[model samples]
Target: MHRRHAPPPKLHPHPSPLSSPATHPVPYLHRLLSAAAPAVSPGPRFAVEDYLVDTCGLTRAQALKASTKLSHLKSPTNPDAVLAFLAGLGLSSADVAALVARDPKFLCAGVERTLSPILAGLTGLGLSRSEIARVASLAPRSFRSRSVVSGLEYYLPLFSSSESLLRGLKKYKYFLSSDPERVVKPNIELLRECGLGTSDIAKLCLAVPWLLSAKPERVQVMLACVERLGVPRRSGMFRHALKAVESLSEEKLAAKVEYLRNTFRWSDAEVGIALRKAPLMLTKSNQTLQSKSEFLISEMGLEPAYLAHCPVMLCLSLEGRVKPRCYVIKFLKANGLLDRHWTYGTIVRVSEMVFVETFICPHKEAAPNLAEDYDAACRGEMPTNFRFTWTKNRL
Candidate 1:
């Protein structure tokens, strides 16, 4: 009792210069810093919904909907590990948010068994953390898959850079998820069998990466269809034809071919010629082809057969290059300056600099406003002189 009597005079903390010696005083500068700093506290006890909404950046409604799938998640331990790993990968908080929003189940993945291994394998493939982050953000489901490593292994060398691969992922969104052995590899081999070099296959990947990820059976059929379009496999246009036919089923391709035969007034042989010249025209919507046909055949006084032979003109912008140049020609004709014979190809096919130098610059003395009027026409406006009726010039 005597020893316990005086408990060391109930020692107190030294008073801070910034505050009174009451409760628990801290250092003067620390006290002032604390007083000035905004109060921060641990987040509200880790409800999955709360974490999804607050930490993962899902909206309240999205959190509510997505939380149901995560009902088995009792703690934030797994999600926390996943988030820490993603953060280490150089993904910004917003990128994590978007990736989670797109695939909430991504958080439930095993970090050691799935994510860490994927990171290590991709690192072995020489991809920097930023490139891996882009792939993860673009395809989270695939990012968690074991096959992703092999897919990137094959794709990185073919694509030559992570930038092109990311672009393909954005457009297809399923490249990494597709089975590398059964689907992607087989289809790529098929492309090789069809005589596509690494460069050609890489070019095809940029256009229709999904084609490589498609079933081998379907790819073979589509490749056959592309070959039948009369663009020889050796031609540079072969890859263009591959992209054109990749989206169309045999039925749709046939319908489009028949529609082309009817719209452009082409025979079977002419349809082949047009498709070979510009396979992209087959992918154009009916409305786009129809409008171009009407303009080239009716307004421009070109024959339908001529368009079949020069189908590249259909690929040109009717409003951008064709219409503006047509207006310039009409302006020259109205002023009687273009006395020489001129074809639409001569007027429309030259590069912009050449077109201006050849058509607009030469007539500077005749019409001072020709270049100015042409500039306005290129912007989709109709200058007054550009719209005037003029006698048609002989071709």
Candidate 2:
């Protein structure tokens, strides 16, 4: 087209008056200012604003602001020097002073805690104290103190001895189940069977540090908990137990136990007997089809592998118990085994097994719109079931 109009001439950036060799690199001037700043000594020779602009390339206004903020920490009369030192660290003078005033003892304690294991491990290699101190100091933040002596003292003895950091961590586990009210009774042997090791146990403590504060007896209760749940020896009860604690509320736990009794055809007395035993004893056996299958029932959770070893039985008996037929249907549907088509005639014959294995419902697929309703029932979400599933015609 009509030869593109000549492009407007680019305006060359006017060279700054401060761009001469002496002032060319502003950042370099700041670096120079930083290097020239003296340590915190009682002297009032340097004026903050004059040095900031002349040496650090800062505007007079910025220099004034920095000086004012830093006046209390560095000598007020020589603020420029202290400001430069702090600016080098990308910190304000106020920040520097605050950091300086903070007690470092807590920091030292933390460092000692972290280094205790490493220092012990190195002692066996015949490292000298001076060498150790140097290495520990170089290891970083807050290790430069004499007070950490006790921390080191406590850990140093384990070096070269048969004991190890792992052993010490394990000692923490024994403390967890000591309290009577909160005892966990985890099954360590089951944990081992589940492929967990000493390292895993240590990791568990780290994940829940409060476990260390737990009484040893309470910890024992938790460790033996899987066994008490009556889970099979071959199952991964330990992991299941951990998940159980996460998912099961007290009401849910009881409901789940009841489900187990119904699903497995366990009698009320049988379920009660199992639960009454020590938690470890629960894991000693699996659900059994007892001789009186007509009178008893048992069921377990979807993840009942852990509960298999627990002593709490989920079973209830229909032999002497009386309830409305509607109640029985609700219970069966709640546990997910209810089938409305079956009349009272069909259910009563196998009442024990059917009631244990199935849930009750007054109608087919009751509460279908209740999202996760089916799952919640399967999980025994209800607190209690007042009746049992019954049918009359089929028998």
Candidate 3:
């Protein structure tokens, strides 16, 4: 009696076209209804810090630190997918943990859109799954970018092999971020233009990857400095020379050049001759140059000009090859076992087996303890025969 209500509309066995599930998919219908429904308060906002610790395996400290980036993370849905994708890619728990700690925001990225495409492109480039995983773990910030695959493609050929590329990448943290076309490609092209072959470029890039990654203009200047050092582009040691000069400023390089000249008592022309022969001398430390000069010039009685003529001698080890072999040669000479004079360079550069065969084995009966004494001298010990050589020199 309070009010008359209209009768309820009769239900049809078949649903109306507007409400048909075929026309409006079930998921779409659910979404549409949700959109029309009045807003209800969402459950207590997702606990990002706790989720990071429990699900992502982050330490409380890591979670606390990483949570700041994911403060707006409302659910674990995207992170769950991302973690699953990483696992499928063969990333170990440590890899995932390290990656997340480095870039917590990476977890919130769309897996289907971002991660899958990046992985596919890298695979197409012939990188094994494991290598790709390591790449991601090594460069989290770069891995998040789509441009990383192209960067790797540019580097792979320059490195010549994946193993070599990986080794270089371990030292070069910016491999992924650097612009290959602008910075790296131009430097490599310049190297090629200077008569550096592919093999030579590969060796230099592995030795100092930043050479190519450095700003092209900066690299051109460095190349000019190298050219001024008197190392002809065709010299076998040109790459070695390049590595020596790239790290040093002009002032430091000048200091090194002066130190070498003064320490070796070289005339200006002689300095150029020595550097042209072994450009690696520019990188030798003051102590190294001093020690070698003292040994070759003072103890061995070799002329400064002789060493400058064969600067490769300075590249040999003082304690290992130079001193030990020189002592052996002297011991042989003092004992009258040698019939002919042996060049200092010949003794210093011979292989261990060759030295043992030509020097030790040939006179094993004459000097039974020669091999033993040589071994002792190599370990920086003073052998009796070595002492005898000194006595002979004094006499």
Q: Which structure among the candidates has the greatest TM-score?
A: 3
Instruction: Provide the TM-score for each candidate, comma-separated.
Output: 0.80, 0.24, 0.81
For each candidate, the alpha-carbon lDDT, in order, equals 0.83, 0.41, 0.84
In the order shown, the candidates' Cα RMSDs to the true structure are 14.4, 24.2, 11.6
Clashes of 1: 0
lDDT of 3 by residue, 154-231 (tens): 888878998888888778868669888778778888888878899999999889977866888887877788778787
Compared with the true structure, model 3 gives a TM-score of: 0.81
lDDT of 1 by residue, 272-316 (tens): 888888899988889988888887887767887888888888888
Provide the clashing-pair count of each candidate structure.
0, 85, 0
Better candidate by lDDT, 1 or 2: 1
Error of 2 at 320 (Å): 46
Give the C-alpha miss distance for residue 146 in model 3, angstroms. 1.5
Candidate 3 residue pairs in clash (backbone atoms < 3 Å): none
